[model samples]
Target: MQIAIRADSSKIIGTGHIMRCMTLAHALKNEGYFVTFYSRAHEGNLNNWLANQGMDVRIIPAGSNSIDQYSTAHGSWLGATQAEDIQATLNIINTVPDLWIVDHYGLDHVWHKAMATRSQVMVIDDLADRRYDACLLLDQNLGRKESDYAQLTNAKILAGVDYTLLRPEFIEQRQKASIRQGIKNIVISMGGVDLQNVSGIAFRTLLNSHLHELESITVVLGHANPHRADMQLLASQATHIQVEVVQGVSNMAEYFARADLCIGAAGATSWERCAVGLPTVLVQLAANQQIAAQQLTKVGAALSLDIGQLESHLEPVVKELANNSDKLMGMSRLAFSLIDAEGTTRVVKEIKSLFA
Candidate 1:
């Protein structure tokens, strides 16, 4: 089988979608499938990273006006323009693609509907803001609903945390990790793209709080972070907290494995935390994150905190949680029950069944 993925990774786009797709591509390759990626030549693009993984990458040059328009619409660093990307795909695929997987937030029904003509398309999305015209739709958020996309035409829904395509390593070590009461080892992973310098704000809050139970503070940043130097500099000067800023960690399972608790944005990492049974204090870094933040909290896997309320509310909450080890342990156990680390394997198995 030949699978073509339409995904992008850049400083602004944050590499989450591309990273997840790479996980899928690796699984498919192991099952004897050929995979290729079509991406734009954006600055900080992960074409090299994809190529390093042994996948062929096709880079399309962005049209001048289209790039400007898309950047203005999304943000300047959103990898590539949707119009230029779609046109580039048409020029390459003369025959119908066996399968086309798209992972982009800016792309809406218009883009997916147009691409549906050339292949059986599967869309990976977190936001249900737009309709899709694809054979399969995957949203790996904690409490995604199938009915959220009822307006779409003939799309098979694969919604919820179970469909989260995490790597096999995370699943393998899920059970061995202890979900017990202990001093809080906090993890701060804002997003691959922490545009607002949230880590600094969070760190400040932690510092202002007079709690002493913070055993460790691990901050995970992407190598592509624009503020990497600044974050590193800040970590160096931190006095009260034992801070470590790690960039481009391949083994996230280990970090999540070691943490007694996490303070992270509500995104793809939420599912990874759930898989490892880590009690997490979820924060919505963006407007799109609110739904998942609430859903995960409602499901008893996480505690949701809005970014708007951080200054006034976060310090107190963290200080209180640190003293309540029993509550933290219960949250971890509930999180473990919410997701199995074997989610990627199950998702791949379903894809194979679709092929059959």
Candidate 2:
């Protein structure tokens, strides 16, 4: 069977959608199914990266006009109107796929319905705010339930963290992961784009906190992060605390295993941190992240800090976690209990059943 994945990554759209799609695509490909990606050429887009990964990639040209005309809240992130996007996608695809996976917030039921004529539709979504026209719908947020999408669609729903599309590396890392004891090592990952440079703020907050036991702080930056140079320069100037800036990391699970604590954006990485039992201080980088951050904090799996509160609240929170070993151990235990590292397998089994 052939699969077509519709997802995008840009300065505004971020890379979480496409990254998770890649995880699913790889699983399908490994199971002897052909997979192709359909993405637009937005600024900081990962079209080329997807192509380099040995999958067939089809690129849609970004529109020349302003993005204000589209109606969806995130319509501007699509770089074109829904009609135009559908037309462009139709023009490029030579054959109808057995399954079309849609993973863009800017697109909803309207686009899905139009493409349904060509193939069966599957949607991978985080926000349950819109309706969908799909045979399968997957939302991997922590507290999500099928009732959340009751009014939206009748698609077979895969809700909650059990369906999170994590890479195979996380499973391997989980085997090596042990309970964290102290806050000697820290990791700051603010997502792939980090347009606002939150990693720098977190790094600066740690440096000024003057935690004498800190041996090293590792800051992970993506290939598309605009502030990579600025972060590298800042890391170079640090005298007291050793800060390492790593970009385009393929082995993030290793970093999670080595770190005692993580300061990260509350997006898809929330599940990754939980898989490795890494206690985190989550910052809500986008409005979509608000729910996950709140739920994680509520469940005692992690801590939360608003982006606006990072400067004021981050240092104090880190200090408290550093001084209390019991809290750190408790957080790790709770986090480890949430994920089983078999999400990809479970999702793939369902997709294969569609053919059986």
Candidate 3:
């Protein structure tokens, strides 16, 4: 079977879409299916990184035109009009794929319908604001309900965190994870591309805080992050705390397993932390992240904050959790209960069943 995945990553769109799509593609490939990625050459795109993972990648040349004004809320993220993207994608593939999986916020029903005529259409989405035309639709956010898409599409909906597309390593780490107690070690991951340098700000706040138990701090940065040098400079100045700046981490599961607390963005990484039962102070970096962050907080799975609250609330939240081991334990249990880390397996099974 041949599968074509349409997903993109750039400074504006972030890497969560492509990362989750890559997880699904890897699972499909393991089942003896040929998977190819169709991406655009956006500045800071992950086409090269996708190829480095041994997947067949076809890059559509970046267009010079501005995004259509009438496109979706994230239309500017596409770097081109929806019609142009549809044609460029059609011009690349030689044969129709058995399944065409799209995970982009910029493309909506128009693109989905255009692709559905040529292949079985599937969509990986979080926001339900737009319409879609697909055979299957997956939304892995905690608060998402099937009713949200009732007026939008007739596609079979796979909703909630149960269908979260996590990598295999997270499952392994979860099984081997130990009970987390007080916050001694911390990990800060503000997203793949921290355009606002939230990681550095969080690190600085921790340094000035009164957390005597903080032994070490691990800061994870993406390869596309332009603030890498600035982050490294901040880490170098940390005299008391043992700060380790790791770039482009492949072993995030291990880091989550070892850390007592995580200060990161409330994006897809929220699910990864939950997989390892790592308590976190989630900061909402984008508007789309608000729902997940608020839901996580309401469920006791995490403590939520906005970008503006990081300076004032971050340290106090971390200190309160560190001081109260019982609170930390409860959050870990709730976080672990939110996701089982078998999402990729279940999703892959569903996709294969489409052909069977």
Candidate 4:
């Protein structure tokens, strides 16, 4: 069996889609099926990173056609129109790759309908706004349901947190979930592309606060972050504290297990935190993230905030959570309860059954 994944990662377009798709792709690949990726060369796109995974990838040219009209809120990120994207994808796959798993906001039901003529379709989406012509639809967000996608396609829906697409590494490492008494050894990982440098803001707040109980702080940055130097400077200024700045991490599960408190963006990494039972101070980086962040917080799984509020209120919030060990434990329990860590296996079974 063969599958062709359509997803992109870059500075403007965060890596969440590609990362989750990679998780599913890796799992499917392990089952002896061939998988390939078709991505456009957007500025910070994960083309290179995908190549490093020893996977077959074909990059669409790094430019856009003249198409200003778009239907979805994030469609501008596509860099090309729906027709152009389909043409670009078809140009490479002269013989359709059995199944097309698309993870993009720009290409809606129109794009899916166009591609449906060639092969079966599965869409990975969290935004319940657009329409789709898919056979299977997966939305791993906390509050997602079949009704949310009622207006869209008549696809076989895989909804809610149980189907969260976590990588095998995260699943394996989550067996050693962290047990937290109080907030210590803080890990600040505000989105991979922290254009606002929210991690630096949190770092400074922690340094300035009276929270001396924190033994160490680990700040995670991605290759696309321009504020890497600023984070290093922040670490240097914290003479009384031990600080580690890790970039392009391959072992995220280990960090989550070791962390007592996590200040991370409300993206694909939310499930990773919950898998390791890490109580997080979630920041919504984009409009798409608000639902997951708020839903997680509503269920007592996490604490969500905006960048401005994160800077203004993070100190007090962290202090309160740190001093109250009971609250931390409760939150950790709720967070862990939100995910089973077997999402990869569940999703793979669903995919395989599609062919069977």
Candidate 5:
């Protein structure tokens, strides 16, 4: 089988779409299918990283008509229009792949219909906000239901956290994660592009604060982060806090495995944290993430805070979790129970079932 995925990542659009699609691409490739990506050459895009993974990444040059279909706020974030995009994509390909995976929000039924004549369509969505013409629709978010997408599309629906599409690393690392204890090691990950520099706010608040039980702190910044220098300087000042700013890390699951606690955006990585059973202080980087934070908090899997409230509430929240070891342990168990870390495998099985 041959799979071609159309997803974009940029400073404004963030990295969730391309990152999740990469999981499905990897799964298909591992199952002996040829998979390729068609990503826009947007600033802060991960086209290089996609290529580094040994996948053929066709870069679509971004221009005025470019777009990111999922984004209602920044509809033109893709740097091209829906018509321009599909035309550019078709121009570059030798032949259409067996399956066409559409993972963007900006393009909808109209866009999907245009591509329908080319190949079978599979949609990977989280918001369930728009209509799609799909052969398979997977929304792996917690609390999602077939009904949420019932009106939008009649595609075969795979909904909820049980089918969270995570990389194989997370599942393997979850098995090796240490038993829970007092929160000492803290990992701060603020999405792929922390354009607002929330990572700086988090670092200053924690390292310079009165909370002293923290043994070590690792802040993972994305390659797209414009403020890596700022993060590095803050880490240097926190000599007593055991802080380090890192980027381009391929082993995220390993970090989650060793860390006692995590402070991160409630994006796609939320599922990865849950898979690894890491207690989290979830921050809502975007409006879309609010529901994930809410659902995780509702189940005692994580503690949620809005970005506006982060500076004021982060210390108190971290301190409270630190003082209460049993609660942290319970949170770990709940996080672990939310998903079995077999999301990609399950998704792969279902994809194959379509052929069967």
Candidate 6:
């Protein structure tokens, strides 16, 4: 099968989209499928990384962002004009693909509709916020239900963390790390690129909380984070905290093994944390993450906190979890149940079955 993916990674959008698609691409490759990528050449684009992975990438010039108009219209932190997006996508679809996979929040039905006519389009979305013109839709967050995409036209829904197509490394390490109890070893990973420097905010918040004095507090920042310097200073001030500012951590299993708890954004890491049985405090960083964060919270696996409410609720949360050991363990077990490491294999089998 010839598969092409529409995903981009940059300072603005972060690297999660390309990273997750790479996982799926690798799985498909191993199963004898030819995979290609269509990415925008934005600042910090993942063309180099994708090339390193031995996949053919077609790069398009970065789309124009109407900053003032976007902010005024939607109060959006990340917004692109529909015309620019449509043109970019049209340029990509000019070369037909057998299966087109799109993973972008800025795109909606307009792009989907145009691409769907040319290929069997599959959408990778965590947010059911927009209508999609897709044949198959994948939302690999905990507690995602098919009903969430009821409004989508002609969509085959693959919902929940059960379908999370994680990289092989995560699956390999899942069984190696037994759950650690009575330890306050926590991991703080915002994302590959935190545009607003939310990690610094989360770090400062941790310093003020009583949990700062816990046994071990490890801060994991990606190389692209703009606030690494500020985080370094914050880590210096907090003596109890052990901050590790790493770029590309090949041994992510080690971090997951060490973390008793994780405070992370509700993106790809949500499923990774669930797979490794790391209890999490989910913070919604973008509009797309809001539903996934709440859904995970409702499933008893994660504690959801709106970015705005973190200041007021964080103190009580820290005190409660630090004091109550049993409750923390329960949440950890709940998370462990949500994802199996073999999710990639399951998704692949389902896709192949569609052809059969």
Summarize candidate 2's per-residue lDDT along 222-308 as a digit string, tens digits: 768988888888888889887899988989899998899999999999999999999999999998898889999999989998788
Question: What does candidate 4's lDDT look like per residue over 1-356, in tens digits?
Answer: 88999998888888888888888888889999889999999988789888998888998886574453755777778888777887877887745788999999877888888988878999999998888999999999998999999888899999999899988777777787766898769998876688888888888888887786888889998757889888898888888888899888988888888999999999989999999889999988888888889998999988877788865798889899988999999999998888888888988999999989
Worst 10-residue lDDT window for candidate 4 reads 62-71
After superposing candidate 4, which stretches have Cα over 4 Å from the reference? Answer: 68-70
How does candidate 1 score on lDDT?
A: 0.76
Please tell me which predicted candidate would have the highest TM-score against the true structure: 3
Instruction: Decide which is better by TM-score, 5 or 6.
Output: 5
**lDDT (CA) for every model shown?**
0.76, 0.90, 0.90, 0.86, 0.85, 0.76
Which digits, one per residue and each the tens of the lDDT, describe model 1 over residues 200-282?
A: 67766765667677767888876566677877887888887788888878888889989887888887788888888988888
Error of 1 at 353 (Å): 2.6
Model 6 residue pairs with clashes? none
- The runs of at least 3 residues in candidate 2 whose Cα sits more than 4 Å from the true structure, single-residue gaps closed, are 64-70
* Ranked by TM-score, top first: 3, 2, 4, 5, 1, 6
Models 1 onward score TM values of 0.89, 0.97, 0.98, 0.97, 0.96, 0.86
lDDT of 3 at 15: 87
Error of model 2, residue 194, in angstroms: 0.5
Off by over 4 Å in 1: 65-83, 92-96, 239-241
240 Cα displacement, candidate 5 (Å):
1.6
Candidate 5: segments with Cα more than 4 A from true spot: 66-74
How well does model 3 score by local distance difference test? 0.90
Q: Sort by lDDT, best first: what order?
A: 3, 2, 4, 5, 1, 6
